[model samples]
Target: MLTSYTIAVIGGTGPQGKGLGYRFARHGHTVVLGSRSAEKAVPVAEEVAARLTGVDGAGAVSGAANAEAVAQADVVLLAVPWDGHDELVGSLDLAGKTVISCVNPLAFDKRGAHGAVVDAGEGSAAEHAQQLAPEATVVGAFHNVSAVHLWGEYDYLDEDVLVVGDVVEAKQVAQDLAVAVTSRRGIDAGKLRLARVLEPLTAVLISVNRKYKVNSGLRISGLEGIER
Candidate 1:
């Protein structure tokens, strides 16, 4: 059995953040949906809580300002837009928490969306997060999971999330959280430096999603240890 965690989602009003927050809350984790405006977040969090009326793990949702969310969470998931990544991290003091970086740096034009080439000065988003919050155990994950499926389509997620981080215990916490969200498995893709490769993969999945009109996800073939 996994220990229940107070999970804070930074951009919890947005589609991706909201979906992830909903799933976590429905599975017994305490979810704090955070937004720049507390007014906006509170309503959305209430709506999500209302939807879980008859669900098994209901009534565990709440909302707050971004700073308060981080202050109260055992694990923080950074789901903000790439443009806002630096500003958000700099303002928070994530001294000894487990931080998961789920931002995929990407851009779009007339043709389609593509991964933005970020210098990061350190490595990738997770690595950059490590620099900003030097005492936090930052992990890169949730890059390939579809927000649509998370919120609207499936009750049980059958996908693999590539979890990359230097800290072993933090990575295990991420993997456990992944499993708690309806059987989704978190695969240890490598160390935190590997995020440079994992982040760009989201762009390719988006391009395919545009073509097929499907909220497609990844499945690892040979991961025997990860339970379904």
Candidate 2:
């Protein structure tokens, strides 16, 4: 019983956002790719829609201004950069919405990427998001999913999506979306606080990608028969 949702992806012009929007549309969810302005987002949405024109089970894809997109959807995904996170989230009215935060706070240097220190909430981008939008049920997920693999031609991605949140129902929505993307397990990793660990963990995966010259992802074992 897959439920269709109207998903608004903030920063949807970015690679990660566009990739996730494609998957959501592929699964029959109406996807609105949000940018600072409709002008920027519309072309990208048209491009994505063009790519999915004949794909089976694909749903409608559109574009709008960030706030307008959020106003039109029940579910909103924050995929913006860490630098503009607070201001963008604070400006939006996310009351009574299921908000998914996949914005990893990371900084790159000559030494490669590392987790940037988050000053608000519990020191993770998700927690900070929750802090800014107290009325929104925020869930942390899709942090480690590769944009490259997501945009690839594969029918299903091969990896586990770890979901963390304080609210059970909101977390379940994220987990369901994860399964929608992977068609596999979406593990309930733990509470929202665990986002502290998960956000930083992406840096490690990025390093692995650089070292191996491949897009790497996570897969958990030992839960074959257990319900997620």
Please name the candidate that would achieve the greatest lDDT relative to the true structure.
2
Taking the tens digit of each residue's C-alpha lDDT, what string does model 1 give over 60-153? 8999999899888999999988887898888987989999998988888897887777784346888889999999999998888898888885
lDDT of 2: 0.92
Each model's TM-score, in the order given? 0.94, 0.97
Error of 2 at 79 (Å): 0.6
Write down the lDDT of every candidate, Cα atoms only. 0.86, 0.92
Top-scoring candidate (TM-score): 2
Alpha-carbon error at 217 in model 2, in Å? 0.3
> What is the RMSD of candidate 2?
1.2
**Model 2: ten consecutive residues of lowest lDDT:** 116-125
lDDT value, residue 126 of candidate 1: 82
